[model samples]
Target: MITGKNYIGSQLKAAGTKIYKTINPQLNIENPWSFIEATPEEINEAVALANDAFKIYKNYPAQKKADFLNAIAEEILALGDELLEVYCSESGYPKGRAEGERGRTIFQLRTFANMLTEGSWLEATIDTSIPDRLPLPKDDLRKMLVPLGPVVVFGSSNFPFAFSTAGGDTASALAAGCPVIVKSHSMHIGTGEMVASAVIKAAKKNNIPEGVFSNLIGSGVTLGTSLVKHPLVKAVGFTGSINGGRALFDLASQRPEPIPVFAEMGSINPVVILPDALEKNSKKWAAAYAGSITLGTGQFCTNPGLLLGIKGEKLNQFIDQLAEEIEKIAPSCMLHPSIKADFNNGKEKIQSQNGVSTVAEYKGEIAPNYAPQTILTVDGKTFLENPALSHEVFGPFSIIVQCKNNEELLTIINKLDGQLTGTIIAEPMELSNYNAVVDALQNRVGRLIFNGVPTGVEVCASMIHGGPYPASSDSRFTAVGIHAVKRWVRPFSYQNWPDELLPSALQNKNPLNITRTVNDIITNKPI
Candidate 1:
């Protein structure tokens, strides 16, 4: 029966059917044969199938599409133990994270279902005729969002469930009636396969056309590059390293028909500690920064990699306390061996830089594939002169930058690249004079936080996940939250179309009764 974990839908057994393995950094054991990786041919077929499905899936009634998306969510929840087990085994993340991620995945799918069924997300706008124009009579004009064609989604390794197979990108695209072909992350292939199965099952149950959703697995970039370059692809959703994402962006942009690549990439999430804020609560600030920098072994994209503070006794106290706290925390396992090697290399690079001091070097023995949390300090001049220090280390490591004055701090912030989030730890009085800091930070990041940690991302309508340039390939579209759907949709306008022929969202009678702009006025009435 070949029931020992293989590809779904098409029944193609992976080559050797034994590429899956688990890297437990804590124990340093690589367990093999947990699952299999789909071959490149299989990947090609998956995209072709999605392209084939788009012919009918895009035209399916919104209600039916919503049913399919909701059904997929329900089935994923049904996977239950199987899903959690595979998720834990593959990534070494705790069960709590797995369950939370599962809930988030389900919530995302159902949220998209709600958005589709409600039908207002299309943002229909209609302008009735101006019958009494002196020079010319204006006919009715209507506009609404429509699905882009096949969307290529590259799942992120850090977030296997919530940003993976049937994650936000796929959910949003499916809800908008766009077919999705996911390039599964190699780190969590088992989770990807399980989620892919759920999606395929739901598609069949809801009579969704074949190929509405497909999954591909490859450790290398061949399959991903092929899918992105395929003439049929209309958009891409990527969540990974700046280097990887940038490669895909370049490929997509250079295509004959340049498509949108929403790539959420690197971040150093700098936390600025104002002088008064530091003096008032140096110890507390030190502890908070220490925890944030080491959380998840510093694997989180929003981990506070950089800290900027004015040079003074308060800052020195904070640094001393931070070093003490970081060293006390037990070292933990990183995601992979390659990641650990890269982290150590990056740390060495920073240390070798001129004028950089090792505030705290973790001298403990790190288990294979594990990274010991380390904190380094550098003067503001050294930091400003060496832009290479700004690069992401992707492990439990942090750099404290000491500035002589507020102007130096501002210069440092201004010189920094775009980030996912920039935080300010400030006393009320200190914050009052930092309007320029706020403005500069706002320009440099997609989200600005006040007196809070940047580790947790809230999924909501207003959340802005993407930032300029290296933070993400596109800042106009977000990779998380409800607004993520915009990446998979494009606005289409119709002029003087027959009332009966117009889409329901734009018809004169307003059959959907969705909110729309009529004569530049917001209303739910027919034009």
Candidate 2:
């Protein structure tokens, strides 16, 4: 029932010499379906179609856009169990995870739908003319956020639903009135196409333009590179490894007209454990972290890969109990064989480094692509002296750093690279005394968690999923939440223009009934 063809708008095309098949990671076998990679010509055509669609989609009424978004969610939900089956078969994830992610995806789509319906995302502003001023008269100026043309979204390998084709990037781009061209993740192209079909069906149901969405199938760099360097792609959204994201970032920057690439890359997500917390509730925190470190096979970007604490008898006991807790849990199959191999290689390299001590490693392996849980520890001096020791291993793996004292711990925390999230475990009011440590962690991470593991990210209005460089290409934008739409938009001003000729949101009539800053005051009043 799956068609291994590219969704170039509403059209399905299978014209390309390059072909690949999805692998059943648990069985280490190939799936029956074969996918045709998108050729350069097909890529060009998709971008051209998207650019054309953007011209009209950008000016659509907020209600119309909301309708399209709601339609997408409905169609996806219609897929139901079939979608979950294919997702589980291709990605080796359980039905529960697939269903949960599908629900999250649907929730995200509906959230954007509601946001657009409310008609307040534009951030409209106005300053009326002062023609009778004593000095030079001020000209009327109005400004609001507008779509930034076509966007290219690269689907994530690990997250087939929430961050793949028709995922956050696609949802936010479409919500901002920009046509989206998604480079489907090779690991789950079938799953990608399944979701892409729902999107195309929704587009038609809602009477949206033909090129409002496109999903391209590929397993190589050629497809992604061509799209990123294309002149029509005004912005890009990517979620992947550091090297992969940086490659697209560099390619986009070197284009004839440089475009923005909002890439969510690597993060260690360091967790600092203060002394009092260990003395009071060491066992509780230990049990919690054991589950968090190995959650979802440690595939989460916000997974607490690094744990910091001052050296003491209590810390040693906590470490031992935590390691034992991780080993007790069963291992799960990773998304692909390559991911398993990478985990093995990266973990081995980190373990081989000097002064590293093994805590607990899962000795019972189950399947072809199952990742074994690992917990390693090293002294603070060794970690600080060796910068290579701080890199992420990217699986159900964690490294605990034992510091001589709080000073060394803060120094180690201060020296870390940019991260998606950071955590501090301490007794009540203990964090207040370590203001400098808190500030240092705050500077290094985009989100700060107090006495909590950084495993689950809540999708909402106030969440900051992006952080300083290496965590993401830019810290000012988020790849989650409703605000994610801002990445695909830019501010535009209309100066001294007639109300009839201006955008509906900026017109003096206040047709949208959305809040606007008029003469430095926020109001929804009509002139």
Candidate 3:
């Protein structure tokens, strides 16, 4: 059922001569399907279609949009075993992981759908006219969040389901009334094709406008650059490497009409283990982190790649225990050969650095594309001196840093590049003494964890899945959760406009019956 073609406004087309196929990393062989790269013409047409669709689709009632989203979830679930099989063949992930990610993806879609039905996400506000004011009359002003036109979403390499076609970026954008054009990740083009079909089917069943959703296939930068630089694209959502995300961010910034790019990039999520905690529960903490480090082959952005602890008997014992536990677990296959190569390159780079030593590494020979879990150790002085030590290795690899004192630990935390998460392992009440360390970590990460690993990110209204600088292009906006819809919208105000002419959410009649702020008071009442 995979067409291996571009989805331009619900129609499948393959006019380009260039073609590529996805690799089955588990078997180290190419899949049967061949995908055509999107040409410049196709990209332009898709963008234009999205622009046209946005004019009509942006004004759709919340219920209709919610129906569309919910339908997508249903259609994806209908994909059933075929989807799971293709996902495993293309990405080398096990069936269980595919199912789990599929569940997460469906949950995200439904979460957005429910949010739309609830209808308070727009944050509408109104101030009635004050014609009887003592000094001068004030004009009536009504404001609400409105869609920001078409958005370009670049699928992440690691997360084929949750962050790919019909993923968070697409779901949140459509929920916010913005048309979406997704540049499918080449590694999982077949999976992308299947998901796109489901989305298009849902769109048609719901009578959603054409061009409201598109999935383009391309291997490199040409198609993505065209989409990002297109005059119609008002925003972009990306999840990938720092270089790749930064390039898109730069391209969007340099355009004639600049657009916002919410790019979730690299992170070496750091963990700080307090002395008392290490002394009291070194074995327990070590076992937990060993699992966290190798979870999903450590492809997670929230993987604890760096660990900090005071250099002493307790920290040394914890390190030995962690090394022993990690080596016992077998290595797993990476997503692709390129990813495996990158993991090797990153490990080599870290090992080549002065003062870096391997404390533990999987010594057994593994199949092609399988990554070896590794644990490296380095002194705080060496880690602080060399910025390369902080770079994310992007696989089942971690580095434990031995700090000389509390001051040095705090300094190292401050020096770390922005991260998606920072975890602190401490005995009860032990955190009170390391206020400075906690404060420094707080400033550097989007989320701070206490006595826990940062492996799993919960999807909720409160989760902050972004951070400063390289962790994400914009820390103010999160790449996960319901609030992500805010990234695709902008506030618009109608001054002295007639109630009948205003949008339902802002109209004085309160036809939608949703919550709103009227004259600084939260209510659902009509003016």
Candidate 4:
């Protein structure tokens, strides 16, 4: 059970509220957890502390900030069994998922730490003064990335560890030298508290300010709204449903100061199966897709909710095989009871839509809170006509769309909303004729997968985990990989300042000895 002792940095205070622990619906057991709702006063205090921390935190040396991030990762690892247990109890996710997400969280923190020590990510540039130009000599200009102020991060329920407190948003913000306040997901408050403790420990070890990172627990939207609308909050990061993310974006934009909100909303993550490819590997592809759709009970945002294909005998064969394979898989519990309820509702709604047919559903009774893996299909014309088919169901369910022709396939892809990923399953020769379809997919999604499942996200430097509106608040930026830090930073230019007065990344000598672009060439030596 969490006690007052667990509230790191800040003393536990009474805010005139009753507390309740979240129950595990699958196990029929009460988890040892309760969260203190942050009053309006507490919210202001947290944000104020973060704002103050930003003053020094934003200007702190990159190496020092790196140390803090690395320490947090280490402390989280040190939590070991305790962290994973809390994750599973609160989220109802299995042990493997809890551990995997914990690892991803740690990897994210350490990756940013590496970025800090290695330097050179700042994208420095030096334009030597045009001393002999026909026009008046221009001042020598230098540019590099600089930290924004305090940031507010809203964690997603699906990934409480990797996208919650001390997750990608907080890690990247800290890496960029910005203070962070995480609006902890109510679904996994225990996980959030454990991670918050890790951050506090790291802050102490690194001698960073106490308020550099704060975690606020709340079940409703009020706390999140206050944080994003708060004047001191300079930026926001979020991952959740389209409705929730859009509301936050609108709130931020409506603010008097109008801060940037990088919200990774919902995605159907469409997968296009070409006729030839289906014909070539119908059984194998069907099996692989069954695994992907059922993996993690389809909790992943990249779950291929929409499958598109040109209508033919091959397509029919593939759908039948897929239905058979999907039925063979067992139903699993969703992350939370609320999620399961919503999943069932969404599936029913989709099934009720005109021209929709249920291909597969759990025949046996599912235990409480379990999600029955379901497969539904609709024609290309009906899918295109009904916008409801395009929405995300957020569970282990998939809708197969049979397009009448290549043109219909193209039209469906074009008409679809933005997505985190768009996949193309094609035979080698068939791909040569589908350049337009591929190009259209690329334009609509942040990442394009070729003949591969989109469920597994590779944590690497080049990965882009964000996409166009509804998929994410900003298509220009990414939510994962080394580039996630870009969300917490903005470009700042200095014009001919004295070498000693400039930031280290922009100084004349570049004492950090990082590479800079000069005369269209990357060089460590400054011009």
Candidate 5:
């Protein structure tokens, strides 16, 4: 099943001479599957085909799009155990994680499918003409969101299924009626290829346009750079490192016709443990935090990398207990050796910095590519002064910042950059006392958790997975949920157009029966 070729639309092309193989991080060896990177010419062809496919796909019926999405979900499930095994082989993640992520990917497709069928995603609005007005005449005006042509999606390395080939970004763009070209991640290219096969099969089965989706396999920057810089590519979606996502944002922005790049880069999600809460249940909170920090090997973007608390007797007890709890958990392997190396280097750099002290270190021998669950502590003053300490370590590691008092803790939260999530661990009515601190956190993060860890982002309509710069390129849109489709669509208005020319959702007959605003009233009624 490993073809070692790029899936350009409906056909496989192996025109590039450069070849790479997916590595088995658990074994510290390379897998047998070899993949040829897409050439510059092939990138152009894929982008061009996507642009052409948009002409037909952008106007396709919603039911057809929904069918295509459902088919993709079905086909991925049909791949079954083979896909899960390859996912585990490519990345060092366990079988349970592989299965769970695959389930998330399938659920995302089905969620978008249901959203499309419900048709409210169109956001149709209308204002009937007032021809006989005494002062002036008001012409009939209708507005609705429309697809923005072709989109380029960069699959993530950490999530082989949920945020990779058939991830949220790709699913949302396709649901918005835009064609997609995926820039497959290098770490899990084999898993990506397997998922890409299912996508192509579904597209063919539903008779969807050929170029509606394409998967290009490239281990370097050339293919991705070319895809983003291509004139025909309208919007971009990415889930990866800050440097990589920022690079794509820069490239797309420099083009003559700049496009929107929704990059969910990275974040050091912070959790504030108020003094009262610490005093109430210091040990309980400590154990919970240890699990949160090391969950999924700390590979999650929302992993609680930074924890804040007011310095006091209770806070010290919490810190020491948290370190002890973390030391008990066994080490887990990262997705790649490079990732583990980076994690160790980050830990060392923080430890070497002036005024930073090691809180806990797991000295246990780790398996190949395994990361040690470690914790370090630094004064709030030091953490605030050293910007390097604020960056995400991207592994099973977290830094605890002990503030001098509540005022300093509030100041630190206000100084932080955008984050995917920020949590507040408070006692009863404690939140009301720290209004300024809560307000500061809300400003810096997309989502606020009252008393919970930031991991395990739910795939639902209410979740917001993007934040300000560095957390994501554009905080206005989310990379998760039904609203994510907004990133690939723009509001379009029509004036005095005939009913026959209007889209089905906006037609006078209420053909779709979706709720819409007409004459300033929301209804599912015909005009």
Candidate 6:
């Protein structure tokens, strides 16, 4: 059923001569399907249709939008085994991983649908007129969040289901009443096409406006650049490397009317181990970290790339144990040949650095596209001097930094770049003496973990998936959960507007019956 054509507002077209095919990384061969790249004309049509649809879609009622999102979830589930088959063949992930990611994708859509039905996310506020005040009378005012026109979502290379087309970005944008245009990741274009079909089916089933969702195929930056620079695009959502995200961010910023690009970039997800804990639980912690570093072939953005500990006999013991444990785990296939090549190149670059020593490596012969796990060690002074040691290796690779003492460990943490997560492994009473270290680590990461791995990201309201600076473009927002809808919306105010003309959430009649602040009081009652 894969047409290998672009989805331009419910219409399929492949006018461009450019064509490409996805690869089966496990088989190390191209898949049977071929996809046509979106041309300049197709890109323009998609953006134009999205701009036209936004006018009607932006004013849709909360219940209606909720219906559309729910329908999308249902249609995606309807894809059944076909979607999973495509996901596995295109990405080399196991069937279980494909199913899990598909479930997560469905859960995200349904969660947003439920949120819309509650109708309280708008944060509506109103202030009635205050006549005959001491000197000046205040006019009535009301404010609420409104959707930005159109959004461009760039799919991620690692996650085809959870972070690609019909993922969090698309679901949240639709929930915010903004049209979404997805720039499908080339490595998994087949999977992207399948998911786009489900979205289009849902849009048609729910009578949603055309161009409310689109999936465009392109292997390079040309299509992405065009979409970002388009005047009709009001915002962007991206999850990828720092270089890729930075390029899009720069393009958006240089536009005549700059737009906000919420890019979730790279992270090392550093883990700090206290002396007492390592001395007591060296073997246990080492085994656990080995599993975390190799989880998902170390492709997770939250992978523990760097581990810090005080240099001592206990630390060396932990390193030896970790190396042994990591070498035992079987090597796994990466997403694609390019990803495998990059992982090898990254490992070579780190190995070539000064003062770096390999603790252990998988010496067994591996199949093509399989990444061998590696563990390296370095001293605190050398790591601090050569910043290159801290860069993420993006595979089943981790570097342990042996600090001179607690002071050196704290200094290293202070100098580290922003990260998605930071972990502290310490004995029950060990934390009381290292408050400064805890504070510094907290200041540099979005989420701080106590005696837990950062490999899993829970989808919920309390989760903060974004962090300061390089961790994400804006720390104030997240790329997960219901709160993500806020990224595609902007707050607007109306002064002395007629009650009948005001939005339902802001009207004096309380037509929506949703929670709102009126005269500094939170209530659902009418004015």
Cα RMSD for candidates in order: 2.1, 0.8, 0.8, 1.6, 0.9, 0.9
Error of 2 at 426 (Å): 0.8
Model 3, span 1-527: residue lDDT tens: 99899999999999999999999999999999999998889999999999999999999999999999999999999999999999999999999999999999999999999999888899999999999997999999999999999999999989999999999999999999999999999999999999999999999999999999999999648888898899999999999999999999999999999999999999999999999999899999999999999999999999999999999999999999999999999999899999999999999999999999999999899999999999999999999999899999999999999999998998999888899999999997899999999999999999999999999989999999999989999999998999999999999999999888999999888999999999999999888
- Whichever of 3 and 5 has more lDDT, that candidate is 3
Candidate 1 stretches greater than 4 Å from native: 1-22, 34-41
Q: Would you list the clashing residue pairs of candidate 4?
A: none
Give each model's whole-structure lDDT. 0.83, 0.92, 0.95, 0.86, 0.91, 0.93
Candidate 2 residue lDDT tens string, 340-400: 9999999999999999999989998478799889999999999999988898888899999
Decide which is better by TM-score, 3 or 4.
3
Ten-residue stretch with the least lDDT total in model 3: 219-228
After TM-score superposition, the amount by which residue 60's alpha carbon in candidate 6 deviates from its true location, in angstroms, is 0.6
Q: Which stretches of candidate 2 lie over 4 Å from their true place?
A: none
* Each candidate's clash count: 0, 0, 0, 0, 0, 0
Query: Candidate 5 overall Cα lDDT vs. reference?
Result: 0.91
Model 1, C-alpha of 410: deviation from truth (Å):
1.2
Q: Candidate 1 — which pairs collide?
A: none
TM-score comparison, 1 vs 6, better candidate: 6
TM-score of predicted model 3? Answer: 0.99
TM-score of each: 0.95, 0.99, 0.99, 0.97, 0.99, 0.99
Clashes of 6: 0
User: Per-residue error at 262 for model 1, in Å?
Assistant: 1.1
Error (Å) of candidate 1 at residue 296 is 1.4
Question: In model 2, where is the ten-residue run with the lowest total lDDT?
Answer: 217-226
lDDT (C-alpha) at residue 326 in model 1: 85
Highest-lDDT candidate: 3
